[model samples]
Target: MTDEAIRTERLSKHFGRTVALEGLDLEVPRGEIFGFLGPNGAGKSTTIRLLLNLIRPTSGRAWIMGVPVGDVRAAHRHLGYVPGDVALWPQLTGMEILTYLGRLSGRVDTAYRDELIERLRLDPSLRARSYSKGNRQKVALVAAFMTRPDLLLLDEPTAGLDPLMEAEFQALTREAARRGQTVFLSSHILAEVEDVCERVGILRDGRLIEVATLADLRGLNATVYDATLDGPAPDLSDVPGVASVEPLPDGVRVTLTGPPGPLLERLAGTGLVKLRSHEPSLEEVFMTYYESPARPETGLTARLDR
Candidate 1:
């Protein structure tokens, strides 16, 4: 089997003059938790549908585990998917829905399905029509996880989930990665992506903007430090990582771009009474790219950057 679980070759799709996706070349290696991020109408859902072979691309090709998406029946058998907008048989109970899907899948582990249902706090006895949006989402999540497929495609999987359930979902994602499942998670929730994804692809206006590992993105984020010192603040204006400095009533507020070692060493030169630092959230990091003109990800120079 190939090391890559998913690969796209200049994949594109269009409707009339409306381009849903354009020239998207991507590769998702097996056993990695990869996040797909974008704003609304950014073609994220369109990409998911193409990869699942539910919608044919206007141009380009995609492969899953070396098998082309053209043979969707064969390619999809090894994968489980959760759509952003889940539609179920209104009259069927959650249990019935799972059972029907399980029978179709031909290999669902019943015990695992029940465990997932319990973990997601879903009441399977209730009919789909009676379930709330979050509950319906939970049902889809349970169905996806229960199959324990080799690859999982999740789009906005946590949209209707509450904070507590969102945390549980993160735990589930980690467990899935540990089980060697390749997960392609598409979400607008930056914090969830930061928590679960090893690497991420950001899309904009049907085009891939960039791809970066969490570590690579962290380098672009700036950290802020508020200090209360006994004496005058040390001279850090010339420090390599120091971005800016502000004199306050108590001490200095410093913003750092890269490593903290230089800043720390500089601060040590003076008497340090107290110090606190706040790291930028992943949302803040994402904004840097979203707001700025496109810069190729320094690390993904060959693919995403180009």
Candidate 2:
């Protein structure tokens, strides 16, 4: 069996003159929680739809659990998916909806399904039409987890969930990973992805810009240090690896790119009261890509070790 849960090659989808996705290539390993991140109109949904084979790609190909996406039945047998916008049969009760979906997948673990329902705090007896948006999301989440498929493709899975429920969702994701199930999470929520995913791929303008672990991404950018001093701050502009040094009210704010050794030595005897290092958050890294100009080519992959 293949170690890859998902793979794509030169995947492109064009709606007339509009390029939804272009020449994309990616691979998600088995038993991993990989995050797909981008803003609206960044082709995040398009990539999922192509993987699901809901829409035909104008060019290129994709596979799920080593099964080509062209064979939807075979490929789907190894995966469970939760869409950004869920639509359930209005006449069916939540439990009925679950039953129908379970039968279709033919892989439901009834005991586990019950546990998920309880954990999500879902009232399965309620009719679909009466359920609020968050309740609908819970039902979908339960269905996706109940199957325990090889791969879970979740697109904005926590859309309507409250903070508490969102936390529960993250917990469930971690549990799934521990069970050796791979999760492909496509979300605009940086915090959610940063909390669970081992690695993240940032997409922009229909292209995969970068793929790396959170630590590696942060390492690629400058590190910020805020120093509070009892006296005047020292000049760090000439210090090696120091990108920029700004005078703060109490001391100085230094942006360092590489080793901190040089910067630390320069700050010595400068009346340093406190020194704080700020690693770039996922959101900050994400914004950097969006704010910067798009690269001329795709496949800027940064597959780094943890």
Candidate 3:
């Protein structure tokens, strides 16, 4: 089997001149947790649809499990997918829905299915229409996970889930990765991606702009440092690798985007009564890119600069 479980080249899709996806090139290696990140209307759902052969691409190609997506039956057996917005048989119970989907995948492990149901704390007896948004997401999750396919494609899988359930979902993702299953997760929830993904691809305006590991991104923007001195802090505006410096009530706060070694020494020389470093949240990191008008120009290179 090829190391790349999923590959797409210049994948483009348009809806009456409204471009849904534009020249997207992506790869997902086998057994890795790859994050497909983008905000709403960024073509995340459209890309997944093309990969599933539910919709034909306007241009370019895609492969799933080494088989072209055009061959629906050949690729279908190898994948387990959970759509972002689920529309199920409202009259049916959650148990029935999961069982039906699992059976269609040509697998029937009732014990395993029940185990998943119990783990997710889903009340299978209730009709789908009565379930809340989070419960509906749980039903889809149980159905997808029970199939035990080689590849899993999840779209915003944790939407509406409670904190406890979200943590459980993260654990499930790690377990699947350990079992050598490839996961293509699409989400706007940055923290969840940071927790579960090994590499992430960011999309904006229908274009994929950056791809990098979490550690690499953190290194690009090191922890912010806040310090207060007995006197006014020395000017750090001219220092290299320092993105911005702002005055604070106590002293000053510095946002460092590169190595902190040189900057630390510079600050140490000034003498400090107290010092504190704060790591930015995923949202803060993501916003840095979104707020910037200039493009990163290259995949890995763009991420480091941002």
Candidate 4:
């Protein structure tokens, strides 16, 4: 009913001296697919647990579809979640596990469930004990998706899935968005996130470092242009928006930040033989924040804005 599928205010969690999550303030709009990205031990799972009310936060609060997380039954009623690692009763078949979970959720569209099973290529007849990790992941995905809840909280949802299955997962995510479902996807797979997510939040060391659209993030970083020339390279160090220009054996590698117009204008008369431009991949942008020593409260996006 609420416009926001999820909202958190300075949410934090700690394990004794260890801070699992700290001062996290985030809001996910209804029908949006939001990506939560961070490396291991970055408190991604901790944040999800707090949202699910599986663990209490040390400070602050969160709400799921207008219900406070403290009210577990009401909050959970609007969402379905799949953990990073799945475990099923070894004696039960995949179908049984799905049926039990469906009952626990208080809702299930059997037709949709069957469709998901088929699309994911899951054999529900197999015993859980005999299923490989990928198969187990498939089962969990089906269980979470079948209900068509207001929000789907997935942490590493594609961990053991092969490329083909990963593609299917992306398709499912798109379909969910088309049906106006919000998906909170926590993953380290940059390519998958880039392919499916409209916006992403990057976390580091239990802190939310950045949150923005992928295009915005890419715009903030430098773009590399490798140009091969028939003549000597021109001096482009003083050009505006030019971060650096390194001379190559044949030409020069120009690192431009804002726009290509200025750089292109400068290289127009320099006998441009061949030119190739490289946009920073999402992985590169992620690494810039991940590998940075400074943990600025405002994040790189803020600094880049100035």
TM-score of each: 0.80, 0.83, 0.84, 0.83
Better of 1 and 4 by TM-score: 4
> In terms of lDDT, which candidate is stronger, 1 or 4?
4
Cα displacement (Å) at residue 69, model 3: 0.5
lDDT of 1 by residue, 225-271 (tens): 88888889888767875655778788898767667888888887798
Error of 3 at 256 (Å): 2.9
lDDT of 2: 0.86
User: Which model scores highest in lDDT?
Assistant: 4
Task: Show the lowest summed lDDT stretch of 10 residues, model 2.
Answer: 297-306
lDDT of each candidate versus the true structure: 0.85, 0.86, 0.82, 0.87
Show where candidate 4 strays beyond 4 Å. 227-275, 291-306
Model 4 lDDT tens row, 1-306 = 789999999999989999999999999999999999877778899999999998999999999999999999888889888888999999999999999999998799999999999999999999999999999999999999999998999999998999999999999999999999999999888888999999999887788878899999888777878999999999886677665556899999866656788889889888999999898788656544543333235333321110
The superposed Cα distance between candidate 2 and the true structure at residue 112, in angstroms, equals 0.6
Candidate 3: segments with Cα more than 4 A from true spot: 227-254, 258-275, 278-281, 293-306
Our tally of clashes for model 3 stands at 0
Q: Sort the candidates on lDDT, descending order.
A: 4, 2, 1, 3
Q: How accurate is candidate 1 locally (lDDT)?
A: 0.85
Model with the higher lDDT, candidate 3 or 4: 4
TM-score of decoy 3: 0.84
